[model samples]
Target: MTNSLPTESELQEAWIELQEIHETYLLPYEVKIPHVDQYYETARSIWLAVLFYYKEEQVHKDVISDVCQRDKPGLARDQQVRHLKREGWHLSGKGGYHSLDPFQPSPEWVTERNRRSGRLGAADFTQLKKFYGNACATCGAKEGRPDPRYGQDIVALQHGHMDPAKPANDKDNIIPQCQFCNRAYRSDYVFDDKGRVYAVADVGPVRRASRQVQKKIYEWLMSVFG
Candidate 1:
């Protein structure tokens, strides 16, 4: 089978920020490569799965299983994935779906999928800014306001995709987002016109689940991350 995941070289190229993540956030090695040689392949496979989904939330065990055939296919997917998370990948996984942090720089395919440029024209972006009153559509922060987190820096409105799986340059599916919120949600959620979180990309495992089960999952995540 032709592997669908991006090549390791491509991942390394797109995620240059990963070098910093390794030294600061990740565990054990203070380096990307785990010291234990056997677990290394499993770790590598999980990353490929993450990059495959890119910004899209996914039910990824199957993908992981496929890619890790050469790594550690027999190992439980969650354990391997959690190892990376605990070891320092800023990932979110629960309710059987996983999503990568949106703050990471993404591959070109996001804005230019299927050879269709989603948001190329500066005129379109200019119009979007005007429509949203020159403010971040998601956070309502006016462009050039001082960023609360970045001292002496101003907030800049960016083109954030509503559905990352689709071509992002399309005016219809795009929203004006502050750099903060754009990376905060990624494509993990869907929002409404009022810029409230509307729904998650929970189409798979969450389907047919009881309301109690859903609520428990929600509460569990809150407690874990809280």
Candidate 2:
């Protein structure tokens, strides 16, 4: 519900500790942090961005690029960010670049401790479904109708986050999605209310394509659908 940013004091402490780790080159949980440069570069900037913007906002991809992009030229900024989760950075996508601050208790943790404590109520969920015509907002799979992709007799819909990365459990941030969508698609790409793939963080999901070809595809999409 609330966004958190690292304070100046926290950043200062992190910087001091960063130097210590760099000198010692110790790994936490047997995970290597790569080579740390006193002057922050691509990897360092990414870690810093995720930490600073944790728990609410997405890490700014453009700012990360501006700071340092010494990695692959073909890699998109969001793509660079997605890999952090593998490195034990708690991040989420399929909406935008979102992160969970390790220091903070996430909505998941809270809900585990107390069910529906900060989630949408049944009344709000019903209203949301009605607004979207009791159908999957992304695929138009009407509730009780046969599944579109699969041959199920009934397509049950559930409360799905508009941006799964953020903790907006309100109706505004929710939509109806079938179980197939909620789990299968997950948050690989951010979808519009209409269920269109509006934003993609990584090209891997789209498969490997040259940068030039990808640009053309983007232009074509914007021209035709933007």
Go through the candidates in order and give each one's C-alpha lDDT. Answer: 0.57, 0.56
Per-residue lDDT of 52 in model 2: 46
Clash pairs, model 2 backbone: 94-187, 138-195
Which lDDT tens digits does candidate 2 get at residues 1-226? 1123344455446555544543353243232354544334345544553344343456545544433444324435544555555544434544444454443333343434334222243357776676667888777888988885797668889877677666757555677887778777666667666666677644555566687888888899899998
Worst 10 residues of 1 by lDDT: 105-114
- Candidate 2 Cα misplacement greater than 4 A, ranges: 1-123, 201-226
> What is the C-alpha lDDT profile of model 1 across 8-80, one tens digit per residue?
5554443454444444543232323333322224455345344434655664555555545534557554445
- Candidates in order, TM-scores: namely 0.36, 0.36
Residue 85 accuracy (lDDT) in model 1? 48
Relative to the true structure, candidate 1 reaches a TM of 0.36
- For model 1, the stretches where C-alpha displacement exceeds 4 angstroms are 1-123, 202-226
